[model samples]
Target chain A: MRDRTRRLVFLALLVAMATALHVVEGMLPLPLPIPGAKLGLANIITLLAIYLYGFRDGLTVALMRVVLGSLISGMFLSPGFMLGLSGAACCTLVMALLLKYTNCFSMIGVSLAGAVGHNLGQLLAACLLLQSGAIIYYLPVLLIAGLPTGFITGFLLNSLLVHDRKSGILRDLVRT
Target chain B: MTRADKILLAGLLLISLLSVAVLYGRFSIFPAKAEPVQAVITAQGKLVRKIYLTEGVNSSLVIQGRVGPATVEVDGTRIRMMGAPCTGQVCVKEGWIGRPGQTIVCMPGEILIRIEGAAPVDAVTR
Candidate 1:
């Protein structure tokens, strides 16, 4: 029972961390000229949760981050929220599947796939809302942008994983 | 680091390059023809008016939106927001748009100006 409570608390902390990242990322001016393009810095926490805990927990964290982030940012129930939710859902699903089904790809490959999935999902939402397929033209630009951002997050995750393995800090927390 | 990772990376790189090439081709080879057709204005999610965009013709409208009055100006083949009560003035800053699917929205004023039947582009940059 204590272990369960601890795990819940830890998950809540992760959710909070992810929310902060999301909100902070929103504040930063995007270097790219494209509207709605972002580095997706908050995805780091999602990848961490997936790698350490599991898919269910990772998905929960992603969903919580999106909802809480939007609410705090005062964009709840808006088109931006819808896009963020859809993107988060697609990213989490693809990353989870990649991690679960294949050992050939590492964290980097999975993260890249998640980034692509996120863009595709957002484009889908935009197309539906605008009632036009012309948004697909943005796909190539989005995919190109996703590459570097995804690589950065994946690299960060890999380093964190390495450190955690050596220190056993995260493992201890999960076990307790 | 793994074989699969290398292959995936290469594939993504190839796709990105190809997309860039396609975009370049579309822009340089066949520039978007600016054939202004008609402009549609909406306020508070309701269609307010539609005006045809023809050369040597100019029109202006003052629309009472949810927040306040917004002035839209249509000159020849281009349309723009001349003035709006919204604080941001982003709509006005959008300048002129004569292409279809391009939109200038003033969220605070709840006004939307969209051009229709212009060159069919994949999407508007802004």
Candidate 2:
């Protein structure tokens, strides 16, 4: 019982750290001309969660990060918040499922799938909310932008895992 | 690259190329600069009121027809039906729209404002 409690505490701490990263990344602007496009730094934590914990835990952390991140940003109840929420949820679901099925797929492949899923979700939500199918016009640009960003995040996550493995930090965290 | 990686990359490149091509086809390379049209608000082609979009570029024009009051905001290089007494309020929610091929329409007031502008520039022309 004590060990379980400690594990829960550790998980909660991870969630908090991920959420913090989400908010901080959101504040950092991209040099891109598009309004909403960015590096999606928060996704790093989600990818890490999947590697260190599992799919379910990674998904929970992602949803919480998006919800808490939006609330903190004061974008709660706005169309923008809804878009972000839907996008993150769908992306996490798809990525988790893909990772579960394709045992041999690399982190890069999973990240690409997540990026594609994210863009699709946001586009669908925008089309529904705005009642304008014209927003689909943005999809190509969004997809093209998703590639390099997804690869970068995936690479970072893999490197972190490697470092953790070398230091025995990953095993320690898992035990806790 | 692995076979799977190569396939994915190719697919993505194709999609992006197609999107650019479609957009280019729809919009002219060099957009024709438009002289702001002096329009008269009308119902069923009958002139109800006349307002010059040039003078009130940042302001709006409200036309109260038999239905109700119809507010039209004339912004730089564009005109929009800002508000209406209609139930949906869809037009008002459209927000600041300055792009061509975009419009705000109030069915009750029978008011439609088409924002006039040059098409997007093409890279080839530039």
Candidate 3:
């Protein structure tokens, strides 16, 4: 149907935007002392997709972003690729579940959970790859960092959602 | 925020505080309790060698790592990576590590240099 096609086109655009964010973030030099810690700016698009569409569509966008982003960055099939995949998977799943089950959590809470889940997923992947639990030491730092980063992204998404709702952009997308 | 959000935030705050407390406790309280005696080298998850770090001793080692060659040097109380084939050379840039629990890892070379018997808690945890 036309509705399905329109939704597909919208999702593709989201994927492209998410990939751009991911690639751009990868280029910046973060001052964090931890090795793998990042702001995860691209997750904003994932959260938006979930809020707009649903879990399946959000997950599709997240996975597509990770894959295509890594390919474009020339890190496909590398350790970084695996880490990104695991983190994005956990982030999307946790956010989707939270959104589905609880109305109590605002987008901020959901974004916080997603960020924490992403860090935990990356930690798990690092431990498995290195065969060392020493990586767990980074957990506290990552968690502490996640709080602020998640809050910023969540705040941005909340404002953006409010504006879109007022403009009827979200409703139009949902209708088509 | 709702009650649920408040609870989640409180829980995360507690965890972060606990982690920071544990890290501080490990570094400040237990540091003087143990002394590091040796440096252990591992490549590809296998033990490559163990070098004793004694005063007035100097040693150097060249390891055939996964990526290429890596060189390590130990001078008296300090140990460091002299050279490595990895692109970043971060291990070499780590300079000298004389403390127990300190580690210099060359990921591309699959080389790890860890100071053993130095601290009661692992450095990563610290």
Candidate 4:
């Protein structure tokens, strides 16, 4: 019972931070000239959850963040919310599969795969919503932009994991 | 980054370059024609309204977007998004588009404004 409560608290903390990052990311204008392209900073926490607690918890965190963030932003049940849902679903699934199935993939490989999956998923949703096949042409630009953004998020998560290992704060609080 | 990661990144870059090359070829083969006559607004891929731009007349138009109403301005032959309900404001930032084939898309609001239909050639031009 005690351990379960601790786990719930930890998950809540992660969800809160992830939601904040999602909202904050939406507010900032991306330096990249491409419309709708972002660094996806909230994904770092999702990756952490996957690495620590596992894919199920990671999925939970990603979905909860999207729902709460969109609701807070007054975008609930909108096209943007749909895009977020598809992106997060694809991203988390790809990262989890890469980590679990592949030996050669470290965090970087997983992150890159997640980024690609995210763009493809969101574009698919956008195409469906707008009923425009022409949007496929934008895929190349999004894929190119994903390279750097994915690497940065992955790199940050890796460094954080290293720090967490030494500090053991999270380790003591949550049972994996 | 692993050796496979480097290889994967390189491969993705190559694919993107190839796609861009193909897209460029397609674009060059069929250039975007100019001299649009009407601004067509669509929400969630469904036609909402079409406003023909009259000569020397200015007007404001609105369409129901996902979040709220998206406002657009039409002036003579030019059209631009005046205010947007979407957070990105990408549609508003697209500025004025006076030619056919230009579009302002607000993905968040599920709104797409496209300038289409070429201006008719008068007797002298014909």
Per-model TM against the reference: 0.70, 0.66, 0.69, 0.67
Model 4 error, position A157 (Å)? 0.4
lDDT string for model 1 (B1-126, tens) is 567877988899899888767765765443545654899999999999999888888889899987899999999989999999888999999999987788999999899999888466476443
Model 1 misplaced stretches (Cα beyond 4 Å): B22-126
DockQ, per model, reads 0.35, 0.13, 0.26, 0.25
Q: What TM value does chain B of candidate 3 have?
A: 0.65
Q: Pull out the clashing pairs in model 3.
A: none
RMSD of each: 10.4, 10.7, 10.9, 14.5
Candidate 4 lDDT tens digits, A78-160: 88799889989999999988878887866777888899889888888989987976677788898889888998898888777
Provide the lDDT at A125 for model 4. Answer: 90
What is the C-alpha lDDT profile of model 2 across A77-141, one tens digit per residue? 78888888878877888778877777555666677778778888888998999897767778878
Q: Give me the displacement of residue A106 in model 2, in angstroms.
A: 1.5
Q: State fnat for each of the candidate structures.
A: 0.55, 0.13, 0.47, 0.61
lDDT of each: 0.86, 0.71, 0.87, 0.84
TM-score of 3: 0.69
Cα misplacement distance, residue A56 of candidate 4 (Å): 2.0
Model 4 scores a TM of 0.67
lDDT of 3 by residue, A30-141 (tens): 8877666778889999999998898999999999999999999999988778878899999999999999998998778898899999988888988898898767777888
Ranking of candidates on DockQ, top first:
1, 3, 4, 2
Q: What does candidate 1's lDDT look like per residue over A1-176, in tens digits?
A: 99889989999989999999999999888877877678888898998888777899999999999999999999998888888898999999999999988999877888888998898888899889889876777888889888888887877877887798899998898885
DockQ value of candidate 1: 0.35
